[model samples]
Target: MLSAVYKSLKKIDTYLFIEQRDDFSKVPEPLLAMFGTAELVTVLNLSTKDRLGIADINKVRAELAEKGFYLQIPPPPENLLKEHLAKLKEQGKLSEKYNK
Candidate 1:
């Protein structure tokens, strides 16, 4: 089965897959808001080998057939400690703004 792949404009590596282009409306409102506007990545035949980076082809197909959309969350950053430190640094700066 073929699938429509979309990338989230606001979030990195987040994707939404649907069976047809017209089926985008079937995606839930909360999901749409979280994903923001999705840019079309490609139309792919799911049976093809390695069509997806992380998600299982069978699970993707099952979700689409049952739920009309499949949400693909990004894998965690490779450097977990570094990401945590960066987030803490950012939050520290934001907190300073309020303290001033």
Candidate 2:
């Protein structure tokens, strides 16, 4: 799932990948180890059964499949989701990410 991380990861003061899917049971330990003690990265784990326990893994997966990758630009202050939402809603089907 980390493969779908946004290219511009921002303000990562701390992070925990609240894993809700059964598929992602292993940490990207090998990748992390490469950095070693030189870097400071805060990684934590949380199963789908966290606070609210909202496991929308399927939705996330579908979104990733449609986009050929999972990524989300943080919403703008005015919330432009409607514009994208409209475009997506208008489509009868989803397609893999098209590199425009």
Candidate 3:
């Protein structure tokens, strides 16, 4: 991952706005991804937003620290079929000739 980051950086010929910071050896990959994806260096770098994200993650971590408390992944909503079929009807795609 570090190598890929370096290779991408070498390809770009401009100031990347990398800030000086302490060691981040203990940070998880998911959290690390946020560093690059959150536009912290470009858009808004308000410390409050980062604090909120960390607070949320800390709550999840605390829940997992419980004995035998497995995290549950909720399934996606399933009631959108009727709505999608309605859209298809409006588009005239629900007809047998159009479906073909």
Candidate 4:
């Protein structure tokens, strides 16, 4: 099925997908408000795609079929410092004062 994809102006990497182009009626008001203005990204043919860059194709299709819309939010930012600390601890390099 063909789906219209829109990028959220207010949130980076956030997208909204709907079955029909220019149709936001299926999307709720609170979600729309949070999404802010939307800019059309592309019209994707889900039938042709087995997977998407970030979102799961099956989940997107299921949500579209059940709710008429699908929302894609960015993944949480990586905690590099926390990861580094864990790595250091694993390597037995982290000081006891810092490990606590």
Q: Which candidate, 3 or 4, has the higher lDDT?
A: 4
The local lDDT score (0 to 100) that residue 51 gets in candidate 2 is 34
Each prediction's total of clashing residue pairs, residues at least 3 apart in sequence or on different chains, is: 0, 0, 0, 0
Q: How far does residue 39 in candidate 3 sit from its true spot (Å)?
A: 9.6
Error of 3 at 2 (Å): 23
lDDT of 4 at 24: 97
lDDT of 3: 0.34
Q: Looking at model 4, report the run of 10 residues with the lowest lDDT sum.
A: 91-100
Ranking by TM-score: 4, 1, 2, 3
- Comparison by TM-score, 1 against 4, better one: 4
The models' CA-based lDDT, in order, is 0.83, 0.35, 0.34, 0.98
Runs in model 3 with CA error above 4 Å?
A: 1-22, 28-86, 90-93, 97-100
* Number of the predicted model whose lDDT against the real structure is largest: 4
Clash pairs detected, candidate 2:
none
lDDT of 3 by residue, 4-80 (tens): 01112222221112212222343455534534332212322323333322124343334434321112233445878
lDDT of 4 at 83: 95
How well does each candidate superpose onto the true structure, as a TM-score? 0.71, 0.25, 0.21, 0.96
lDDT of 2 by residue, 1-100 (tens): 3321212233332222322322223435553343232222322232332331232456545554454332233333565765665566568343455312
Query: Regarding lDDT, does 1 or 2 come out ahead?
Result: 1
- Give the clashing pairs for model 4: none
